[model samples]
Target: MDPPSSSSSERWLWWMDDEKKHSIADTIDIEKSEDGEKIDARKERIRDCMTVLGGFLSIMATGGAINSVGLLQTHWENNQLREYSPQTVGWIAGTNIFLSLFVPVLAGPVFDRYGHIWILAVGSGLFVVGLFIISFFDNHSAAPVTLGMMISSWGVLCGTGYGLIQTAVPGVICRRFDRRRGLANGFSSLGNSVGGVLWPMLLRVALERLGWSWSMRAIDGLALVMLAIGNGLMWGSGVPAVGIAARPEPESSDNEKNKEEQEEEGREPSLTWGQCIRDGARCFRKGDFVWMTASLAIFQFVVMGVAGTLPSWGQQQGFEDASLFFYVVAVVNAGAAAGRVVVGSISDSLGRFNSVIIVQTMVVIVGFGIWHNVGTNERLLYVFAALWGFSNGAILGLWSPLVGECVHTPAPDHIHAIIESLRLLTELVCGVSRLCDVENFGRYLSAASSVVSIAGLLCVPSSAQILGTLGPDIHVIFFGTLLILSLMFMVMARVTFTGYSFKIWRVV
Candidate 1:
């Protein structure tokens, strides 16, 4: 072959690059075509549907671990840390709950930008490590680790891992499902309820047979097995790969090129972090986002608070049998699981906002009408747990779809979804704070929870303080009031977004 001229070599390289670009483009097109075809496929072939079962199980594991903190809290109080104040012990579980909720804000963006594999890998590792750490901690040692130390090791570490997985799983479903998005989300959320039901019984059994340390280890082992299986399923799901760039089409001719150049010059530059912050601030200023955020925040604050405290409250109610006390938590969660499926399925038909309103109304009625009056009557307490659990579960299941509806712009974009997700996740941080006893323990726990109808807003220590100082009757009233206020906010959000027409049953 004769030596090519520089111009000819340049032409050859350009042609190669063009060929490569076309190949990339073709790959993307094939991927998109496959996605579309899968969307139209029979239910069995849909990757999203295939993964839903695994995702549900993954979420069930996550929820089980997170919600099981109540059982752990009760165990620690009654067995491991009898001398410690309830408020002091409460921080351990509270921090775990707080971090699990808050870390999702950070995780969501990452999940959106990256795919599930690395996130799941890191999350599973951290989650397993956190569980192992909790399992190995020995209270009988010469220098027993303090409650604060446990919080750092178990709460922060495990919670972070939980947050990563929790955020990623739902984001996967969100990207996968379109027509059945609500139902898909609902199924995933049902995992939390399932966890709530199963973990208590499991933990109680472990506590009875294995003791606290070994019980944690047993749970850890279960988590390890489940996460391994879930991770495998996730790896195989063939969800879209991230970070691939789509090739821009070639511009034709000088006049066309000139128009494109001019349009590019006119377009807004990519957003800077400062600009994004400013934009998010502006979005939050809008009434719809604010009200929706507030309602969601209050609901989470109350529900999580209640969930964390419920086992302890059952103990305080003179439920001497530890098994029964744990079962109370299970019953509530069981009801919630049922609610998640039923409410989630219906939300697609009934307006998301309307469904939430109905659920919240039921929560208020349960909190005040049933929960407030239930004394030592075990049957009534179980009834209250069932009703409250169902209503609250429905709220949790519906909130995501509701937020999606409220913040949804006409033409959907990643930035908008990220903003909405961030807003919703960030708002839950407020509820997380309410789970622990900060400086304003009694007032914040009692007043905010009551006003917002945050069901289980009382931290263990604070619940102890309130139950001791103010009485359980007062605590019940606080929760009832919180439910009432939460109901009002839900109503306000619905009215603000959907208008006053009763005919519009479906808000989302």
Candidate 2:
């Protein structure tokens, strides 16, 4: 039952050492777990569930609410602030998005070292402060006001509050469930979907009915409600019970053998400012990391491209209501929520890497292209948004689980942190700046998005079969047999290629 201390490289120390397993399970005190010492689990599932609910709310409150900017650019342009360069205004969001990713690794580790109570409280304050800044700040300042405000709400405050909760909630529920990890994660991821559904509509109504400031403050109110509930969840039920805290037995001696290799590598560095730069460089170097990040980044780029320009694209093609934008965001978020649960559950049965490759391929073809084309047809436009929404929603949730698969047999902590870190780096980028006027720029944006996403998809893990090299035929064949193969890997991580032996790739 003892884990091999010989290998402790990938964050799953439990798999490597007997004592480390205690930290993940019930033996440690939630309070004591923060101080480089093991403690105990509270054994409270109901409260843990509440913590997850709170997390869902917080993510929903913040996740898609601010993404409304692509839609908001028009208003900003029409306002006196029309002088604000697209890049300059983008810094507001870009900063928010970037920091929201980066600051969290440090915070997540700290939450591991400390606890969620203070982190949540502080993060909630930042969220409120951010909301106030957005609601009240006039962009008349000589400096970029939107940029400044986003950093406050989006970067520092949301990063801190949400970061704390994001780390804490799963830690809590994970302690509570063995049979339901996917369901737990899925349930928690839904908050954003719920918010995605509500926020845009609220933004529209409030802008016309309550005005920008009030509408934003109204968002603040909603945040407060979510946080209050989150507080209850963290405070009451975030730890595991005693008996369940025991170290889990390995599935086989092979797990121990894997642990032996890991113990030699040690833990991930507490990434300093320099580590961030290196991560970008390293992301390029590691084949798996490079391909994975590109795949995910292209997904986001497409998302931004679609989000920013889709309405215009729809308008251009003569399906003119701006209403579809919000609906798309909502549907995408909802689908993402569903994707996380379903896909995650599949990962349990299938391999994580396989499920993602399969799902992402479908996402590109069906969710983005086919669905998009159909949307252009008189009736399918709205349906297209709904379809895209479902697929996109799953993409974000896929990160953590995919990370779990990619770096299997590691200490869960380290694996989780790395996954989160890469996400942060991507969010931090300045991105290619937009030049033409907003509307025209949108068309260029979506086209560029499509192109990039297609390029990203070029390296689908097993494309050598048909194209002989990573190329267009591979891209064209996206929704076909490869998808089934990818899905097959989920259930049966084995290659079915004829004449080719299974030794090479059946288990990846």
CA RMSD for every model? 11.9, 17.1
TM-score for candidate 2, please give it. 0.61
Among all candidates shown, the one with the greatest lDDT: 1
Global lDDT of model 1:
0.66
TM-score to native of every candidate shown: 0.74, 0.61
TM-score of 1: 0.74
lDDT of 1 at 343: 82
Compose the digit string of candidate 1's lDDT tens values, residues 1-508. Answer: 3333444323334435656755665676688889987867755455666678778877777778777676777666766677777677777776676667656655544564567888888888888888787666546342247565678766788877887888778767766777887677777767787887888888877777987788878888888888888887766776765611111334667867755764564322233445544543444433444566677766776776676667677666666665776778888889888887788778777778878888888888888888777777889989998888888778876655565565543322233565556545654663311111122221222222222222222344455556546666787777667667877876766644533323444444
Error of 1 at 270 (Å): 7.7
As a whole number from 0 to 100, the lDDT of residue 306 in candidate 2 is 48
lDDT of 2 at 22: 58
